[model samples]
Target chain A: MVTPLEIIRKKRAEAVNRIVSKGYLSTIRVYVGMATCEIAAGSKEVMEVFRQAIANGLTDVYLSQKGCAGRCNLEPTVEVIEEGKIPVKYGRVTPEKAREIVERHLKKGEVITEWAI
Target chain B: MEDVQYKMMLCDGVSCIHNQSKELQSAIESELDKSGIRDAVSIHLSGCLGMCNKGPILIVNPGYTIYGGVGSEDVPEIVQSHLVEGKPVARLVIEEDHLYNRFFRIFGDVDFFGKQMRITLRNCGVIDPENIDDYLSVRGYEALAKVLCDMTPEQVVAEVKKSGLRGRGGAGFPTGLKWGFTAAQKADEKYVICNADEGDPGAFMDRSAIEGDPHTVIEGIIIGGYAVGATKGIVYIRAEYPLAIKRLEKAIEDAREHGFLGKDILGTDFSFDVEIRLGAGAFVCGEETALIHSIEGARGMPRPRPPYPSVSGLFGKPTLINNVETWANIPVIILDGGEWLSSIGTETSKGTKVFALAGKVHNTGLVEVPMGTTLREIVYDIGGGIPNGKKFKAVQTGGPSGGCLPEEYLDTQIDYESLAKAGSIMGSGGMIVIDEESCMVSLARFFIEFTQDESCGKCTPCREGTKRMLEILTRIVEGKGKAGDIEKLERLGSMIKKSSLCGLGQSAPNPVLSTIKNFREEYEEHIEQKKCRAGQCVALLSYVVNDECVGCGACKRICPTGAIEGTRKEKHLILDEKCIRCGQCYDVCKFEAINKV
Candidate 1:
């Protein structure tokens, strides 16, 4: 039986050999806004829904968080990005709605027109 | 290199957190499973995205669509329609006229973001803080790289000096002059400090910066260290801000790994590192001298300044200290020439200011307005013009250390010099909007109460004088104020402001002074008429069941001492002696009964 640590080390070595770029990582990014304005308007839960969705599936998405956009009053903001698109910005998504985003928007390319601005 | 694919992001700041965001995570997971395309989509939770008045935010990447005021129930609909169909969520979209979109509608067109330049907050909400690559993509450490690879220490200091950029952490000291003072000294291990211990009662500009763009501060510090030829830097943040601390720690690790920090950063001779020191939540630590003392493993108390921090700072060496916001600005100033940076704002005050615009405003949140924006624009256009259509009475700037600008001063340009001219100091950019329902006397007393408690017993003027001022304020709020107390407050305030040991004590009297300057009539009414005009001060209030009472038992049930004696559906009578005047009963009453006059 192989030890998990050794296996992880071996896999890491393999990953390094396979690495195309130095000190590089394949990143899938998720951004949650938790500024004071967002809190008052309740964006915390909206971010959490996505977190749970990702944690359950165990996808390799890198999480980056931030503060208010100076818009204040409208909160529970999240932005997702890949290598392009200059950041896909979104605002005011709720928890249950977060599930819809994951299922329909994330899993499928179809975005809920009612929710998308 | 492969182009970026797809993403789904959500808001998870205070506004979203309160709305049970925890449950939404599971829902998203389960929903994605049903679609069998979860592999293609990635979901992430992030901090506040602002414009929280309409919240529970979400943004879908690749198409750049925003949905506002969302709920858990709307999840399936979004997935089935927009997510599956690739359509816009129009119903949830905030369709404001041509502006910065739904995200910054309240602030973008308003003076809060329009009048302000965005040097310090350039990448705040636009970029992701956790990803070094995102920061890199946005030219994050390019400034640091430039400083290390090209400019000499003298050149760096000279450029900064040419910009005429002053410290945003009060006292308005030029950044270049301070850097020069530190650079002139020959210390083997000089230090660069970012004073992130923002202890102002309602001020959270520093907190927002750290939480929003942690790398900017890191880049700023690295640049500052490179400019001053310092090998080390320290960020003194308060323990109360866990999010900021967490992000900053991550930023440090990332910078070190990315060759922006640690030994031979970017394979250059320049080597700099940063550490986080959490202050024990003392308001006085906002003062530079006290902050240095705190960083030196001592109690945060200000010592009289003769040998300033620039000469003999942390650990008995020349140190350069600037606030988080000030540090946040360095990268932009360095990247964009000093001339471009100097062009914005007034001659004295350059760059945009980030303000925690709170209280009585419709779109209350963190705002980055230009230096020369008027109070009217920030309050009206950006703030959504006060909740429930209330008239704007005043907007208080500078936190406890600032003065309240009255309605007459609405059009006054908000720069350090202009604010000071209007009897307020730009103290850390805590702009609190006050409406008609707010009592000036109580407001003044509230700030005095905060200052009195947070005062370190280092200086007699701040310690004893604040206590005296608090007492006098308490009296006025209780409607027990004497005629002569106003004169005494003025005299004492002048003395405290003029004679205090440091910035804390000197500016501690600002709330009292500014409120008095603007609303002296409120104090006079409290003294002469023995009334609390806003009906806030309980001591001056007397509960009486008025004719408008429809026999609602809310007041009776809510009264702490059973002060109200009434049957169901009958007018109540307050037993005044039994009433502790908690005012809970007054707020609970739905009818026009329970008069507090």
Candidate 2:
């Protein structure tokens, strides 16, 4: 339904505006060690939990992923970084823990001290 | 303040963490409170010191003494001896451990640090990945400073050429050669690009590098920019990798703030900066040409290229693109100089390669081995051999685009040329170990299915040929294969490899080709007798209870459908009609009771 001229204009706008305007830069980062060791350690659910949480507006966070930390046994591991603090690496974060992390850490920044990293 | 000297750096690395590490932490805190020496010492939980076996560990700083297997009971002794008397605890101390001695007594010899070269894994377990200071403290930006201050663009290219380093992003193309090609162009604006779109199955070396140590890649790209006369760098990472992207973004910001990335970098006349572009998870977008198009906001499909990215790329600017691992090596090569870097690995490869060693391998994680290291050493010695004591079959090195090498080639030194010589490519170093019980046809189908799902579908040969090949392999695995199916698969595979425009299409047939070549008997049994030798292909399988079965009703209860039929306290039989072949019953039988024929 779009014309070639409109598409070209859209492309031009994309190029020029990306430089001029800073986009929604709030980093909603999530980490899942999907390496073989992490997979064996069950990181897939950790990712799913993040996905579901993000879908639910639990926290406006970046859902990111990483490979193994070379420490493969801590499967379903996650690391969260916000405004001020060292990034917290939370290991074996299950769906339940993930939910709690979203509610406690992501929303309030009161780091769920026990599950924070 | 009483004293802030009772420091404890606990090892919360995966190995220790699993062994009730949190409990150990609580115990230390509680014990410290009881002794009233908590104020004298502090606790900092660090990462894996790499001796993963005996952990739940702690290393007290200042003296940098190490302790292993210290449970809740040992904290009191630790505080009294180290915090109070400032003397080493003899019972809990790790004296014989070479790593501890060097770490505490002397300064060097990073334990578990013998005989291994780290280029890709340079920052792992050493520097806190999230901290730019940790990276800076370890001489991170010195290469950037040297490249800008000392070396000319031509000289940088020459040094890389002399080092003989090649791309670790699968194809093993000579890095210097690619740089020189991009450098040869006299464009007004040039770009340094990093391909972080790692989509290979069971491959995660790139992800680890980016996540664990992202600054290395950024520094490498900045140096690459200096070499190629590029003012801009773009890291084309997959959108699927939120961690790599996040780390990369942080690194870019950090570099800019530190005068390592933005204009007049480190007070030099040179000006360079980087931006990030995200890929929508197409495997083909990993190709340099396709990556260029994607960065330009075009369709992420590759076009025929004589004007390669070196000649025309990213809105037709001259570009130099290297994978994350390739970029990681540049900083090391630059700082050490070419000859020192060239000392390791085979003559052709000239460095270490990081692999995501998975499947039947015991230590299934990231391993970095020098190029030309035999598959035998990587799979057996370093990887702790195969699990369950199964006979080794073949390793699918690279990804779908790489060939499978059999046990006969275990001694073959790992390098681009050597792997290719053995009919397999050294690909992106996804070394997936296969055991005796794996069916070759099913394996091929698995990879083909993966590629097919990921195909961008821009080219005819790739789109159609991959689909056809996948269908054939699927048929063979499901026991619906005909006599000439193998021949058809070969023909289609060869055509796809030859005619496909990009690397993805070209190497798409490698799985089918290599499996057929190495495990021909496996394929033959599947085709000729309509039986799967490995019992992996579900359609060619039927579940039956053998003498090993005891009724117990566990299998019956677990079955989603009423697939199992049996009397109480007796052996259960698999009912063919009612059995949905879900294999739920097979999983529940305690003994090796259920047999699939």
Candidate 3:
């Protein structure tokens, strides 16, 4: 019979496995602000553009949607989390700009200095 | 093998979800899949990280780096460089200095969380609330296990007493004393209840707590039950909080399955179970007696407080009822010890208090601070001061039943006694920072109207008295106030305070009374001069075309009434006879030509 301590250990291990299996240990992550304010600021369209770019065979990218980033005035904000490097936050991104970000920043390892928040 | 080396937590709280966090989450998952490193990374949809205005917020583990204002297009680059190349992204990091300076100015450059002492909110933004394993890993049920295995019911109550926890539901009643009162009663069947019917406008502290960490509240409730010698626990949550309800129900089921709740919990003889009761969103039900009635399937109304829910409550038996935040503090008190918890806050009030900072503040969000923290620190340091550089006016605390304190009271310490002495109650921790632009008369009218509507009419003083007060306040704001209106309001206010049946009636006059006490000059100006200095009362305002008028016909063209007249390229004039005082001309004019005085 499994003791309570054993159950707790099992649960912890399972949780860790679940997180590890889902690629949380991956080196980089991209977060898109999709809060209501961001959506009103056309983050949905920007997200679609990114999806289309990835569908067009963009490789090695981990894209996820996040909630409001606090600054309502700077909606449609994008955050890039790359391992061993400082994360970059880009603001006021449009769909066309989204495509440009994928090609110039994601593909070429270049930071878009102008759009950073 | 440590298969995962990094963790990404995305804020999925109400505000974040409103900002399209779901779309952001899906985008991240697809990017991870595309990167072919899905097995190495984990994405957690967590609760509010408090920096609401800076969403959608993303926190990366290993270094605890937070990135704000993220977008979908930035996903691929983040994965390729950070995950594959083992290099952290420099530009995406939420600037440590900026975040620290923005929210923690009171504590000075400590980061957004530096000023906050998060006791009840310990697990909220840090963990995925829906997952039971996540809760267990955080030592969630350890308190319940300890209470059942080691501490006697009296001993548990004594520890809580030593902690000096007061109800976060607004009354500031000593929680330990309430538990003792209920435990001392001899009864066959007793119940411990969690009051989650958070009905205060602009107050989301309880909702956020439940959403961020449902298991913590459940754990607290189980401990309360053990202390009070109750076998059954009930959480009386409002139906409007569907997300919190969903998570809490899931947590209860998981706890039962894990032997933390139900029949012989943790293999001990002490057994306890919990159930959920939905309140139909009545503000009055937040009161303990009304909540008890609602749980019993009655008309959610409050009777006199002789029995006080401790002696006779919910099916007419001994019961213990605490607010959502009060329950959330339980596990922490057990883990940290009563003395440790007591040492943090003021002498009278112990532990931290969670406040939902709203209104015209720069950094409007949820903040938890120690009890002795002054209102000045909260407004300026943590809330980032009033927005648009407006002069800080009065701040409203304790919902409609609480009073509004003027600028002079800004340094007042935020505890029950201190706030009461300052003419405002600490309430349920809804701190609305009023700006110079807000009219005190109108503000008083708003609270009176709210209390009048929510009054159950059980008592004559609250039901009819509030309506009469609202009429006088309405007349005063409408530029038709008489000399004796203020006196009449004061008289009625004091009468209601003395004669009211429940807490709702007793505190109904607080807003009107406090506003008059603090900003009496504004009231006098509204009555005697027929002018609202803030220009909020439209009835007392007049529109005029100023010297700066460039008359591009913008104001003339948009004016619903043809009050603005003048040819193109010339200064416009407002015809006083025809002007409706709608302020449309003021809004439409590109130049600073139109003025409302």
Candidate 4:
């Protein structure tokens, strides 16, 4: 006999739990722009390169795809997020640059200042 | 176990998806896993964030720091510096100051979103739209619960009336008054209809609202049902908006499961249910009478309306129809009180109005601002002015039915009365900024064509008058203007406005009349001088070789009709008789050789 109040409370608690488990508060997230403009700008190849690199070695990261980043001219946009840090956005990335980022930045923990948007 | 410390929101709206936001998401996840910080962060894929031009946008919580134009390769650096180390990557950060100052010459001292007061769009891009729990967490459905438990039907109506909310579906009918009318009607069977048939071109406020927070609309509709003593609500959304429909369907299902909708809503005696009916993409179906007719399994046509929808609607019973944006505003008005809302906007028009700022502007997207916010602020400040430094010419507000306003009227405050005073109605929030490049005559012709095509043809004035007006406007744009064409158009336009049965017919001639009134010079240039200053009227333009031509022979080689005849490194001659006006040579010319005169 769950009341409506209890159901709402339960839903709220579940939302909090979902948020935590999905890495809203604790996980580093990488968002790749996969909109038509970005696809036209060779984002598909860049995304493929990132996926292959992740499968080869990357860990503790949550990688996902998203829609366009408004700057059409600067397509193939990506944003990275981690707890207690400022999110970094990079634009106009190629497949080779994506691999180099995975090796130097993700693995060795160095910010690639030149590639950052 | 360590507690989560940060939240990251990635915009996954229509435009953002086009920019490869999906790849960016996976790359971030991979980086976080590598850094072993997966347990300390949360990521949300959200809807449009208004600044769609700067997608795929990422917002980090705690500071609301936004990063735009990000790519997969940059994900590693973000993980390294920001995820592992405590410092934010400076270069990638989208500075608030920069967004405000980028077009300082145009906007002067005002910020992009300085005048914007987001009420209906408060939860957009802030929550995951698909997740019901996320919506519930943000005090969603609390208004419905409050309405059901604490207030009576008359009381709810009074509060709404006090809020001074008007219909957002083009005509600014008082929402509270409309509800009161339906409530006063003694009908056993009553219905609440949400007019989600957004048929206006380039307007997407309602679609974005539904996609961003579906639960809000659901809550608002349910509350309206309660207020009007109605047992059933129907969302009349167009089939064209597949994403909004999907999200709304999910939201409705979730609400029913959670006891917010269906029988005995939120532990109260008030029982109401909502269902969706898809419109077959007819622009005329947006009108109340036509919509009611369509809902009744008849042809989508407008009938005479003295016994309005409130008296005799939806199967000969009283029906209350409100726009999607109007319904979306209900929950907030109920929760925050009408006095709070009424205080925000102008004296006449209260609360925020959502405008789809589009066409030839820098920041082309959705913006929700208070009623009194000037067009100057909307175009220059929020929209970042005309793109590529083009001179501002005119702005068309209120869709095809609305009028075009010239540059001098930019300072006019936006409200129902103010817009009406400027010869344009505060339509369903489609504001298209026209630059110097767009010919006013061609623009008027384009809108008249749309209205003419969309007219339901049931009434003689709308169907026949619009057709006649379209013919005259078309001929003018095609360089076949007559002496009395403008006067004939004005006569036909006023006749349509007076004699038309429905709103579609009455407002059909607005684009033509308004453009002629505002940009008469452009129209005269086309008619008298036999030229289009904007070069948009193809019939009025002639291709010629200019003095700037370096005689590269590129135009001669590229001309499909072989109109250009010249020796190598010599001035080209265009045989006007043989020219097809394809403009292929114009595009291929390297030395600015080709000109359209």
User: Which 10-residue window in model 2 chain B sums to the lowest lDDT?
Assistant: B106-115
lDDT string for model 3 (B370-434, tens) is 78778987788777788787999988999888999888899998899999999999999888989
Question: What does chain B score (TM) in every candidate?
Answer: 0.81, 0.81, 0.82, 0.82
- What is the lDDT of every predicted structure here? 0.74, 0.75, 0.80, 0.79
Residue-level lDDT of model 4, residues B136-193, one tens digit each, is: 7677776776676578899999999999999999799999999999999998999999
DockQ for every model, please.
0.19, 0.08, 0.11, 0.13
TM-score of 4: 0.79
For model 2, how does the per-residue alpha-carbon lDDT over B352-453 read when each residue is reduced to its tens digit? 888878888766666776776689877886566888989888988888889899999999988888999898998887989999888878889989998888
TM-score preference between candidates 2 and 4, better one = 4
By TM-score, the better pick of 1 and 2 is 1
Can you tell me which runs of candidate 3 are displaced by over 4 Å? A1-10, A28-117, B1-111, B566-571, B575-578
Off by over 4 Å in 1: A1-30, A34-45, A51-65, A79-92, A103-117, B1-117, B550-554, B568-570, B587-590
**Per-residue lDDT of candidate 1, residues B89-192 (tens digit):** 67886642211232332121223343333557766676556656656655556677667656888998888887778888876788889989988998787899
Q: What are the interface RMSDs of all the models?
A: 12.5, 14.8, 9.2, 9.4
- As a whole number from 0 to 100, the lDDT of residue B422 in candidate 2 is 90
TM-score for each model? 0.77, 0.72, 0.78, 0.79
Which of 3 and 4 is the better model by DockQ? 4
Highest-lDDT candidate:
3
Any runs in candidate 2 off by more than 4 Å, and if so which? A1-69, A74-117, B1-115, B547-551, B569-571
Task: Give Cα distance to truth, residue B420, candidate 2, Å.
Answer: 0.9
